[model samples]
Target: MAKLIALNKPFGVICQFSGDNNTLSDYVDIPNIYPAGRLDKDSEGLVILTDDGKLQNLISNPKYNKTKTYVVQVEGEISDDVASSLQKGVQLKDGNTKPARVKIIEEPSWLWVRTPPIRIRKNIPTSWIEISISEGKNRQIRRMTASVGFPTLRLIRTKIDKWHLGDITSGSYVTL
Candidate 1:
């Protein structure tokens, strides 16, 4: 039988199973499972792990076009122009990103406080936005927000295709 696990990765935890830094093994004890995709140490939210290679590729490969949604807390309030630019596609050093689904959103009510909370600039207000993209480029969400003049203060992946973080607390996992 194939096993799929959805994990709510916490901030400061590395993606891999083995490393000097805190890693998946510290949170997940399953054997023979691998992450379908990766999230940066500074980022939080859903990470899918599975023992099936084909399923991993299906979720992680850009060619499969699995949409991933992120809730971003940015340094400055998101503007109409910034949201438009993200929806129209932002040019990055790697290349032009595919157009994304962008919308200004309120901070998630279920959000947990980071252990080391994000820096607060009393003069600069922060706002949240939701962005959905199909590509899994490294630091893509952070890069995209930065390009739009709103550097991301924190990022959390909320959903991937049909799966979602839902009520899962940080560092918790659900087997499917």
Candidate 2:
């Protein structure tokens, strides 16, 4: 069986195990295990790691169409029209994205404080939205929201297919 680990990777940490600073090695010390998929250095939340190569490929490969769910805080009050656009597919520079499930939501009560925090503009309003997509384009969620006019201010991946971030705390991991 694969040794699977679910980690709540904090923001600013790189995905790889080796780097100059703030890399996975700092949090995960188990040798030979690798991240199943990647999150941006600036994006915080769940990152799955396993020693099984096939399992890693299954989670990261776009062809598998494993769903990834994110809670996003975007600039401005999000609208039904924006949600609908995301659900129908949005035109991106890379090409049109697959339709995503999107809905405006109140800030997640389970959310924790981000390190250094997101910028706040007192004049511009912000809103929270949940988005679930099966495709992982490079920075897809951010690009999708920006394409529809509400730029994402903060992003947190909460789920990846059957595995979830759950209650994993920042910079911590739990073996499964």
Candidate 3:
């Protein structure tokens, strides 16, 4: 049997337990464990790690349609057309992504600042949005917004299915 570990990854930390110096090893020390899914080094929030291969596959595999929700702060207004396009699916260089659930949202109640804040232009407006996707594509949220002319400023994953960051602060780990 395998135990599930849920971690609230802080910004600037890599997903791997070991590897580059900029990784999770510096925070949590778990032997023979690997992350079930990845949260980009620049992104933050709930991540799962486990020793169980079966459970790892279950979480990482897109076939499960395990929806992951992210709260993204972007550099410009989120137009209805862009919101609709994201819901329909954004065409990426790799290919068209699966449709996503996107909506304007207030800043998360439990929001924490990322280590290094995202780049900002003094004149451009910014907004918060919640985007949920079944497929864990690389830089998908950033690319999707850029494609629609609103570049992402900060992205934080709030929940993945039943797992959520909740009150966990950056670099904290909890066993469930």
Query: Taking the tens digit of each residue's C-alpha lDDT, what string does model 2 give over 1-176?
Result: 88999999999999999878899999999999999889999899989999999999999999999999999999998999889999999999989999889989999999899988999999999999999999999999999999989999999999999999999998999998
Per-candidate RMSD, Å: 0.7, 0.7, 1.3
Off by over 4 Å in 1: none
Tens digits of per-residue lDDT for model 1 on 1-176? Answer: 88999999999999999987689999999999999999999999999999999999999999999999999999987888889999999999999999999999898899998989999989999999999999978999999999989999999999999999999999999997
Better of 1 and 2 by lDDT: 1
Candidate 3 per-residue lDDT over residues 1-176, each given as its tens digit: 79788888888888886686879898778788888888888888889889999999999898998999998998887877778999999889999999899998877777877668777788988988899999977888989989988888888888888888788778888887
Kindly report which residue stretches of model 3 are placed more than 4 angstroms away from their true locations once superposed: none
C-alpha lDDT of residue 141 in model 1: 94
**Which pairs clash (backbone N, Cα, C closer than 3 Å) in model 1?**
none
Clashes found in each candidate (C-alpha, N, C closer than 3 A): 0, 0, 0
C-alpha lDDT values of all predictions: 0.94, 0.94, 0.86
Off by over 4 Å in 2: none
